[model samples]
Target: MLVQKNVPLQGLNSFHIVARAQALAHITSEADVKSLLADPAWASEPKFVLGGGSNIVLTGDVKPLVLKVEVLGRQVVGETAKAVIVEAGAGEDWHAFVAWTLAQGLPGLENMALIPGTVGAAPVQNIGAYGVELQDRFESLDAIDLQTGETFTLNAGQCAFGYRDSVFKHSSSGKQDGGYSPIGLKDRALILRVRFALPKPWKPVLGYADIDKKMAEHCTDQPTAQQLFDWVCEVRHAKLPDPAVIGNAGSFFKNPTVSPEQCTDIIGRDPKVVYYPLPDGSFKLAAGWLIDACGWRGKSVGMAGVYEKQALVLVNRGSVDGPDGATGGEVMTLAKAIQTSVYERFGILLEPEPVVV
Candidate 1:
């Protein structure tokens, strides 16, 4: 394990915003994490865990020890007639893991082909793309409780996953009290590894509207797992900006779910409004459509602008000097504007998916 002080976090995050970490450590093993927590230098210091740093916006410098989980490995732990249980280290790149699963002929994760982040952070947000979510294949995960320096396992049910949220994000308080609070500087835990049960016979899903249309146009009657993966990658690449060139964190907000009555009311007013009926009987409205209808796409406030192709994504096109040059605040302002506009137009509220820190 290597510990560095005053590390620059500009390149660590996908937003490409500059921030400084008071102390940073790369933990290769659980023992290193335990030892670091026991050190007096970090006894009272706040702790933060980082994976790929894909789904976060750093408002300013972090005053805690940012422990980067570097543990790596993947193994087939269990198998059944219907599914195969695959376990991966938390530090494994999320897209790499998806590709590895596709190589092994696993069926479930093909729809989430090119998502950015680490395997560990996948369950943290119950990440979903196209028509699939992590909870669809999640079995369990292991995480270290920073408070007690103890390792704990969380099953799918224990994860408390909602739309882009989980226990690792919603649990814990700054001080020890029975009050609900956001996981902030004083209360955060580290994800260690995740276990996923992928289907064996590979039942490919072409559920999302865009995916279905693309497959239909390509004459794909029954697409294979590899075909689905390839198509998803192509679609995402065509629509979303490559964070490597343009700074972004994928979709900035989640599609707001509304009741059936609310959906009917909204559709009654505007017949062209697009919405998908979820399996749970809720209606998932098109957040991008709402934002685009409000004339936000390609609109820039200062350094941040909505991606012209995908209204859900906010890009940082400002100077790359430092915090002053970053457009984190500009993105938030646009997001808030979209949220307020959607609410005023349709009485539906849009919620941001990324962790705004």
Candidate 2:
């Protein structure tokens, strides 16, 4: 464990926002977490667990003791008749792991290729793309309790996974009646590793229009896992801004799910509203389309701006390498404006995808 004071965090976050962690500790193993917890100075201090910093917006210098997870390793842990279990340390880069799985002849994670952040963070958001979600492949995960320094593992049901939500994203008041109800571990447990159950005889998850467009352009019907991975990467590169070049947290808002009655009401107002039917009988509205309809594309507030190509993404219009970048407050301001406009015009409030700190 390496602890540093006043650690610069602009480079750590995908948004490239200028901020500092009052105290930051780079934890490379479970031993590091135990060691940190044993320290009297830090044992009771409020703590913040940071993964790849991809899914967070730093509004100001962080006050909590930042535990930056850096544990690393990956391997095929077990294989059954129906599935192959692969385990990876929490710090593994999500996209790199996806690519690695394809190279190793494991093909189930191809649809979610090119996603940013670490494997530990993936479960927190239940990150999904091209009709595949983290929960669809998740087996289990190992995490440590910050309060008691005890380690534990949890299965999918125990995670309480939801759309862009998980038990890891909520906090508990410690008032539960002896069972894991709604009380969550949010910031109370630091994930050490994650395991995925890649199903055998992988079947392609292809329903998105982009994949269909790719199939049409290539004159091929059945693409292999590697082919699908390549296509998803290609599609995402064309649509989303690269964090290394343009600095952004991909997809700033979650697609709002509405009941059939609410969908009918919106469609009545605008005949061209884009929507997709979910398996749960609710319609998922395109948040980007809603923002675009409200004339927010290519707009800005201070140094925060919306991507001209995709309104779902918010970009940093400030310096990429200096202290002068889009402040988190400015980004939130732009997001709030878009949210209010969308709600006023469509009667649906948009929820932000990234955690704001």
Candidate 3:
């Protein structure tokens, strides 16, 4: 375990928010975790697990001891006639791992190409893109209990994945009256590794508008995994701002899901509202479309601003190389303002996607 104090977290997070972790520990192995637990000075202290720093906003200095997961490895652990089971350490770069799977001829993750963050964070957020979600490819995951220092594994059903959410995003004593028992692992579990089951009989996930446009421009109906991967990357580059260049978390809000009645009402009010019907008959409304409809694009709140090209993304307009940057408060204030406007117009609340620290 490599321990450090008063570490600057400005560059660690994709948003480039200026902040600090009072105490940060680099855990490269399970042994590192065990060592930290055994130490009297650190054991029993409040803890926080940090992954690629892509899907988080630091509102201020982190008070908990930050465990920066850095364990790294990737390999095909097993294979059957139908699919290949690949395992990767939690700290592996998600996009790089997707590319590696393609290099090895695994095709299931192509639709999610170019997503930022570490593999461990994928399951927690149930990250998705195009038409595929992490839950669709997840096999199992290994994690450690922060409070007990115990290790365990969980399968897909145990993760309770929903749109942009997972058990890992909730607290332990979650609501129990929603026709099922609530199981939230939020702030109590540190994911150590993840496994993916890539099917042998690979089929391309198409029909997304942007993907359809790509196919039309390319003049091809059948796209290979590599082609799909490349297309997704290209489309994302043209749409979403590169975090390295602009300092923003990918998508700022979850596409709100509504019933057909609600959809019809919204459509009646604004026929141009971008939406998609889900397999379950619910309608997914485009958050960016709502924000843009409310005239929030290119708007700013102090150092935080909405991206001019894509209203779905909130960006840091302040300096990336220094202490002067968008405070988490500014970003949240802007986000709340956008939310209020969209709600006032569309009668639906927009849920933020990033974890607020």
lDDT of 1 by residue, 31-148 (tens): 8888887887775677888888889888788887888888899888999888899999999999999999878777689898899999988988889887788999999888776766
lDDT of 1 at 328: 63
Candidate 2 Cα RMSD after full superposition onto the native fold (Å): 1.6
Q: Write model 2 residue lDDT over 1-357, tens digit each, in one string.
A: 467999999989999999999999998999999999999889999999998999899999999999998989999999989899999999999999999998899989999999999999999999999999999999999988888787878899988899999998988825245533436988789999999999987899998999999999989889889989999999999999999877799999999999999999999999899999998899999999999999999999999999998999999987777876799999999999999999999999999999999
Give Cα-based local distance difference scores for all models: 0.82, 0.92, 0.92
Give me the overall lDDT of model 3: 0.92
List runs of model 3 lying over 4 Å from the truth. Answer: 173-182
Ranking by TM-score: 2, 3, 1
- What TM-scores do the predictions have? 0.92, 0.97, 0.96
Which residue pairs show collisions in model 2?
Answer: none
Alpha-carbon RMSD of each model: 3.3, 1.6, 2.8
lDDT of 3 by residue, 225-313 (tens): 99999999999999999888888998999999999999999999899999999999999999999999999999999999999999999
Evaluation by TM-score, superior candidate among 1 and 3: 3
Clashes of each: 0, 0, 0
Q: What TM-score quantifies how close candidate 1 is to the native fold?
A: 0.92
